[model samples]
Target: MTQPSPNTNQLFKILATGQFGTFLTEDGDNKYVLSMSDGGYEAFTPEELERVCPYTIQIDFMAGGGAHFKVPKDHGLEEGDSVIIGRNFGIVKKLDTRRDNAQTAENLRLIVTQPISTQSPQVVA
Candidate 1:
């Protein structure tokens, strides 16, 4: 079977404080595959990783249940891409397919690459 390309219609958001890599501003047209995950309201892309910054996931995606905003197989995303949302980063771990009630499905799993939070422990005096 063949795969489709990315569509600009579908979008996701992220939350960030200081600079956090290359992100699309609200004023610009949607052309990214990865962006803020805390209400970014825009698509994102990782063609450039130099545009890094501090960020935090808008939703609890690294937990047991799973994230709220997820891009199914139809999203046209592939592996080798590291997604940076807020201060969290996950790589397109792998592309796998599962059957759902006889329906063939493909899903992308982003493996968190940030390891741990960059924030330092607070020094309470």
Candidate 2:
């Protein structure tokens, strides 16, 4: 399989609100909730949501056979929106069971890249 572009694997921070209690990872299952400070519940546009965080985006995939997407941690999450990791594979926002069944199915695959040093070790004099 061809490798994904470097930009494709970059991690993007977004803003979103959590509608219900959701987990980040399957193994750890880190529970994250939305901010109640902005009233009981409110609907925000993708751009507005991004302002809340900075990495939020309107994704199109699936979560547990249901449509899914990724937004910033701060973005207001709702029932329709699924909280997923950057590496959660599968149909991001579609009804594909075959793709959904695949474990570790990352929707918004976020990758962190760093520059490598090219300097070589100098001989002791």
Candidate 3:
């Protein structure tokens, strides 16, 4: 099946800090896929690796249970890429979908490419 690309500019407020392997984000206009890989961390150069700070983030859902995404440090988020309210609000640039054989259903999750936190807003303006 074909998947619709996520609007990279879409804004989502994080309801919880992704400190553990789990967190939460406000719903969006589209459904996203959860990534199963290390978001290309294994491909980083030594210099890049030295600057890396990896963390796993999984969006919390009412149904419960989801994949964990190991986001590489500085996952390319830049100015206007995110904001800071009580929690961090970020733009989701990538998304994916999952199909389970047992359930015969497809699930969507956002590929969290950056760390979510209560840190100062990364917005440039």
Candidate 4:
């Protein structure tokens, strides 16, 4: 069967319940969300070196299946917006919402500013 072509306003669905342990935004700013799963999936963390930089931090991000959506070409999203992905909830911190290459039709870069804490799960309902 053929898959449907993605729409600009469509949700960038992550079918696989995989995990991305540590990932940075297109820029230096980072938005780390707790991994929300049913105890079945693949999780990975980025390898790091011991180095120091101004305003740098060491974060052990427990990111789960992202509540992800693609940024439209017209650019409808912005930084500081709130995102609630299942058991994860945070505000958008950094936005690398740009299309520098023609290879891709849209940009999917997002960085949340708020840190994950012991709080209620955010359901986008």
Per-candidate clash tally: 23, 28, 3, 3
lDDT of 3 by residue, 29-114 (tens): 33332221333111111122111123433333333343434444344533223322223333432322221112211232233456
TM-score of each: 0.22, 0.20, 0.17, 0.22
Candidate 4, RMSD to the unseen true structure = 22.0
TM-score of 2: 0.20
Question: How big is the positional error of residue 47 in model 3, measured in Å on the Cα after superposition?
Answer: 26
lDDT of 2: 0.34
Lowest lDDT 10-mer window, candidate 2? Answer: 21-30
* TM-score of candidate 1 relative to the true fold: 0.22
Candidate 2: clashing residue pairs, number: 28
**How many clashing pairs in candidate 1?**
23
What global local distance difference test value does model 3 have? 0.29
RMSD of each: 18.1, 18.2, 21.7, 22.0
lDDT by residue (tens digit), candidate 4, 1-125 = 53222222221212243332221221223222222233332222222211111221111123632222334434444556655434445554444422222122133333446678899989998
Candidate 4 segments whose C-alpha is farther than 4 A from its true place: 1-70, 97-125
From the highest TM-score down, the ranking of the candidates is: 1, 4, 2, 3
In candidate 4, the residue pairs with backbone N, CA or C atoms under 3 Å apart (3 or more residues apart, or in different chains) clash, namely 35-62, 35-63, 35-64
